[model samples]
Target: MTAVIENTAGQGTNTGRSFEEIAEIIGQVEDQSRVGVCLDTCHSFAAGYDLRTPESYRQVTADFDRIIGFGRLCGMHLNDAKGELSCHLDRHAPIGDGHLGLEAFRNVLTDPRIDNIPLILETPDDTRWAAEIALLKQMAL
Candidate 1:
């Protein structure tokens, strides 16, 4: 299911509705198209999903499995979060300097399950991209 939160600002407001209601709508959609989750780090962080600490990262993994299912997660846009956890602020910075630090991203890159997935950094600058990619390469398992 291609689940996009309808209200851009009020992202969590969908929680008010029951999961069945949400599932019903998703069921009606025709195009299966091998549904995949786009893990936009900025959006996940902005929408109150913490990917910083190991425990938080584990929680996020579990939540993704429970809510969206791991089957759909084929790609990620790995940008740095500019604001603090649960801040709901959607700002993107260079890979390592922002709120979601390089260590956290290193941990993510090391995860074996996500190793095959495409991780494209939508960070600020080309220079930052080179640095981040180098950092990622160094950290890769």
Candidate 2:
């Protein structure tokens, strides 16, 4: 439980290393077992990986491919950040309430590679699961 909590809290806060930078560090290991980049909308937005526009989304993804090898990105922790990209604020808003908006979620869900991975929500209210899940479902391809 402590590990889970720590990991959750740790993820919410930017560890300073960029996604690609983290992948490089992880790649230094001898035996990596299908390492994947998990992008929390909050962290990505807070870290400056803007996905609000189509061109911006493509550019960000292209950069990700260059820096970390897109194949290594195996999962996503979908959450909306309360701050603008690069702000580093740790607040998490509901799916569409934050800067990401609904289109960003739609764009992510359409990606064939990412579609099948776990899109877990670590939002503060689990009771709102039904509505959040529905919103995510609507974003699905």
Best by TM-score: 2
What does candidate 2 score on TM? 0.82
Q: Which 10 successive residues of model 1 have the least lDDT summed?
A: 1-10
Candidate 1 lDDT tens digits, 1-141? 454422111145543132233334445667645344556776677666677888888887786677656666667788887788767666788887888887678768878889788888888888667778888888785
Model 2 worst lDDT window (10 residues): 1-10
The TM-scores, one per candidate, come to 0.78, 0.82
Off by over 4 Å in 2: 1-16
lDDT of each: 0.67, 0.69
Q: For all candidates, what are the clash counts?
A: 0, 2
**Candidate 1: where is the Cα deviation over 4 Å?**
1-25, 31-33
Q: Sum up the clashes in candidate 2.
A: 2
Q: Top lDDT: which candidate number?
A: 2
The per-residue C-alpha lDDT of model 1 at residue 139 equals 78
lDDT of 2 by residue, 1-141 (tens): 010101122345435336655665667755565445666667777677788887888888888788776766656777777777677666788888887888888888887767567678867777887899998887784
Q: How many backbone clashes does candidate 1 have?
A: 0
